[model samples]
Target chain A: MSGRHRLRALGALVVLNGLIPIRTQPFYVVYLLASPLSFLFFISVLSSGAFVPFGVTGGLILTMLSAGTGLQSDMTHYRQDLKFQDIVVASPVEAPTYVTGMALSELVYSTPGLGVFAVIFVVTGLANLQSIAVLVGVLLLVWAFASALAFTLATYLRDVRETFMFSPLISLGLSVLPPVYYPIDRLPHWAQTAALFSPTTYAAQLVQGSVGLYSLSFGHALLDWGALIAITAALFLVAAFKARWKEP
Target chain B: MASAVVAQDLFKVYPGSHSRTPALDGLSLTVPTGGVYGLIGRNGAGKTTFVRIAATQLALTSGSLSVLGHDVAREERKIRERIACVPQESRPLYFLTVEEVVYYYLKMRGLPSVEARRRTREGLEELSLGEYRRRLVSQLSGGLRRRAMCAMVLASDAEMLFLDEPTTGLDPIARREVWAAIRRASREQRTILLTTHYLDEAEALSQRLVLIERGRRILEGTPGELRGRVRYPYRVALQEGVAPEELEPYGRVATVEGGQTLVFAREREARELARWALERNLRVSMGPVSLEDIFLDVVGRSIDEDTPAEDAEPGHDEAKA
Candidate 1:
């Protein structure tokens, strides 16, 4: 493809992915509204076959899928034509600025999913007004976390084929092994402790508990937020180190 | 005047799956403060790799590189501030307009909004791209896209500019225009380091030329000095009616084509061969040799012989530039 056409497609795709949610499943919607613990609530809805209130699960799933696809596109298609990293290396723009700019762009593209979840939650009486606001705030954080991780991963993988092959496996492992879809309390003590190492678990826990979908102490929520910040910072640093702006 | 660029024992080795492919094998060269230097090499000759490292876009596997007295490794940010690059096969972001691309680069260099916009306007006008100021880069044709990329670097007010194959796909007229722009930039005292397969380009524009082959410096001198290195005596082109049998009596004849013959001798015997060719009424063309022919003789390969088909022909797009 010509360079211009590829870039136009990238811009369009960014806007499209940012604005639209992947699935309209009722449980997915409920999962978005239940902040940190929505993953836990999603498991309950999946097990009970009950009406699932829109909460964090839906947002997390949407974010994971979007981030995965976004990263794959960057690796496979964009890398061949555009050395976006050249801009960072050649200019004074540091890794944080580059990652933050990309994340904001992706956030703009992914905002519609959160908006849809918020509207559905309020209209269905599945979530209270206060919870919906907190859910929206948490969903923004989730978007930030997803975009950052995706950008970092895109830098590490050498090509699209490798990213495409590896991303889903990593995402699935992170999703299932962490406390994303269920409460840590439901698992064995060792498993619960192990989940703490996964950023997604902290993100999922924060999303579920903050939105009132699941009960958690304020101190636990604070701890999750602190861990999320630390993970984001570390990933940004790793991206700066591993980013190969020059042609291979 | 301080050197615009300096490097010592610059080396870059790409680690392959099993072994390492050395790109820049201890290459070292310097560009003076305000002149155009042409780096000529075949594809995969490490020309692009050298430019990338000097531009501070790539890290050196070993060796030291400095731009405007700033060490690339220790003072990357300072080095970056002084250099602008139009990387090989690169373009501005597809979604941004021509003006936006220029403005964004200027801003990255810490130009204020007003000055950035002013510089953007001037750069576009200089390259005759003012008409397409509002057009998105994605909307431009291939040649124009290249011009826009060039303008971005030019607009940045960088002291040292690195252009990797700047005129690869441009048509003759566009190539001249781009060359004129480079000359103008050089006149403004910006040091330019450019690479191209177009030997005539290197001959016409460069104050000094560095010819590399197999990751080694094969020749380096002023274009005229390199041209003078061709010891071959006389190049004789015959008319279609001339026969090779008739030309063989004068000197050893190498038939280049159906009608063209090249006669070689020592420099002292060059005039003698020309006289012999004329005595036979064989149409003879003689002149100071070009860098192209000299390069072919030294490297035993022609730059145009095996150029990849996908590389756009020079001057294919006009609307964008």
Candidate 2:
């Protein structure tokens, strides 16, 4: 395929994903928000509610998990085929640069889903002017952290079957143990403390705080965002180092 | 001429579940700066492992390898900058088009957009892939995808090129086209190291050939030099009246028909034997020698001969390091 065609295919996928929320009604919205498929679905459904902090938290968690699954699949397939390593070694491209391109592509691919949720919130009278900037910041943070973690985990995966088996297990454990669907105060003190250690919990908290769905101190939200970014950066470095460009 | 590629006592060992099996064992060879070099080997003879290490896509367990005077271990980036490789059974990114695949490599090599475009166009034209430039790689046929891959490597403008089984699944015509392009590339001063199981291909293109069996170099010479080592004279046809036993006194003979016989004679006696047969009122014909015959003599096997099918996998050798 030509370069232009590949880019077009990616653009088409983005547009198709973006239109899903705009054309659907409550049934589709409900299915999206409650399903474990992708966080974007939950975010789209929750955008219709005036005070749905849990929905926003659920959506953020879902987005991270979905992105993780996507990264894991890509990494696993590449390892099994060995084509990725062959291309990297044969071409002049460096491993880190190739990974950076993949990350950026993920960000671009995720834009439409995030944009659709933004539009839904605006049109449904769910998001006020005060929360729009915060919503955008949370989306960016979720994407960066999710993509970085996926890239890092990919370094360890040797095949697609392992990735398929492992990613959902990790996502499922994180979903049940963290503040994705319920507020931290409602959980046991120890569970809440443990949730604090999960990156998805911080992301969920930040999304809820931004949309006015949950009551949180701005300082606490800022700290969560900072921690997420730092973790993403550190994971990125480790992934770059651990990637085996040459076969051993 | 300076050597384009050099290796000394190269070795590679894959850690097996129970114990390590050496993939390459004290293997060493050199290629002159120009012309094609063919690496011929059986399935488990370590050809792929050798190419992988030479391409700097795999690390050796021991020994030194250099390409264009750059050591593969320490000067990998420099060596990579000057070399291009077409790996066996490699495919392009599923989402990328043929043009994109070629352009991406050029861009990575620090070529400007204009130069990248120029090279992509030239490579596509050379490989007859210009029409498929806009199609997704996932949509192309096997042959076209292979062509696109070759174009991608060609666009890199590397000085040395290594192609591992470049025509493995290609049709006869497609294989010829690929060979033509390879010849053109060589004319432009690109040093090519090709590995193929096809004896005819090796004879047609390679100036020097190396035959490896079980991770060890068994023979290294020009096709003529290798062919010269086989002293058996090719047998020709004879009239139906000649009995097979009559030719037995001349050499080892096998009857093909009532009158015809195949005789394997020493190089010195072949001409005199043919003359003697003709004097006996037998119509005689002579056969020409080929690389296939020489390969059989040296390896004690034929490509067409069936061994246990399970022996197709590469065999393990002792690790040099």
Candidate 3:
């Protein structure tokens, strides 16, 4: 009925995120912080000094992973386990606001990934004002695109098991199969062509370009920017227009 | 008074293991504008499905349905603005305190923070959750969690409420507490549509009632009217020493605890039964049958004495989607 309700939903979403750290402390450590950071560390030791910031990419990508996991866990928990979807669906809140509020909440919950990136860059002497600015933009863009896609997919999946079973496959595939962990330029032409479709490839390129880690052609940068905006806008539109608020 | 909700030949066909079955099979019901209306049935009788459709949380497979004169299919937002639902089996899921759960839901329902807090505290006090207002929902026991969930709806000023088995898992005393809270929440402007497995619950709260079976409305009336409609409106109970066959001349007979109970369909039969009981040197009394008896009579037996589970059969999620 009012903008305040949207604000309340957002507030509740933040509170919901805050509670997660306290409730699942072990999960926060083992899966959220440790597992991803450990992988980033593993990748850091093997790569060249110039690529130590590649660890930041791992941290950055995995931090946004909660948006996808939230799609799987929180959406399923709200719909299946707690049966609270009806409560929201029956309210005056629009589906887009609910989806955006929840995605932003997961982003808030996974903010420590920012700290992970900060620590890696500071210790590795790779921190620069311009690179940090690019990293922030990439995080927000990737989260918006990925969360939109995740929200759209959740509209079709039936249960917690299905959401869970498919979500990690999506997040891991998005993170690992793209240039998030490796350089796109060194890969085969076929792999580079495929990576063009992934936003992370461009995101990695954008960050690396900002820090002079990779050579990005001006024309190529224009295409990357277009792909990021176009894909995100399209996904957001589909999620907003087609997400099922009630059973049809 | 205007009808608060109207459903005519409503159908909700859920995908099943092999074939499709209507959860709300040709069911039609009307709930008036004020006081409490009860929908009571056994498991899989489509009470929650009916409530879901009315609340605009699920679409009907066919036929017409509306809430507060707003079409369920086309005017969901208008109906949602006026109605609230306490969904069945919704535990206290959020990590908020008991009071915050109520307060925030009120906020989500469009109330200002101050009023939300005030109504939340009022709901908390009414439901006896005030003592535990500061406690997290997960910290509460099962009954208290249910109380918190009910308070989430009670804290709102919605014109109507769809409460699906609000007292399903409560202890007797806790149940009475919930009933009292529900009574306090009702006003002339408010309509309460609730489902229950407890006959006493229906008898206590409902001004009008509908008894559904497997998604069909088998019986509908005020509790007293329903009781009067019972096939065996008069009941005879004799000591355990008496046999059921001895009362066959009167009416239907069945074994009840500590007695052989006889049911009579008419006053003449009841009079004859009482006279026979007296003449045979038997200790017996004839009384008007209760709503529970009518429920048993309608359904051929009572099966709700067991715990109330909201149709948890496999592959039943399609309707709630």
What's the TM-score of every candidate structure? 0.80, 0.79, 0.92
Residue B198, candidate 3: how far off, in angstroms? 0.7
Q: Which stretches of candidate 1 lie over 4 Å from their true place?
A: A1-51, A54-57, A60-79, A121-144, A161-163, A166-171, A174-195, A245-248, B17-21, B233-255, B264-267, B305-321
- Expressed as tens digits, the lDDT of each residue in B1-321 for candidate 3 is 779999999977654423245677799999988889999887767788888889998778899987999999999888888888888877766577888788767766667778888898888998888899988877788888998888888778888988999997789999998888778666545899999888889889988999988778989989878877777888777764566576677777654664455555567888887887788887787888877778777777674643134432223365434
DockQ of predictions, in order shown: 0.20, 0.25, 0.54
Model 1: iRMSD?
A: 11.7
Ranking by TM-score: 3, 1, 2
lDDT of 2 by residue, A1-248 (tens): 23443343334323222232234332432332334434434544666543354654465456545655565666556644536556557655555555545555544434444445555556655576656666566656666666666766665566567787877686776665687766678789888888877777776677677666568897997788887777667766766676556756
lDDT (Cα, 0-100) at B81 in candidate 2: 66
Considering the two chains of model 3, state its CAPRI-style docking category: medium
Q: Whole-model lDDT, candidate 1? A: 0.65
What does candidate 1's lDDT look like per residue over B66-130, in tens digits?
A: 88899888888777657778878776667677887787667655566688789999888888889
- The candidate 3 chain A region of ten consecutive residues with least summed lDDT is A21-30
Return the top candidate by TM-score: 3
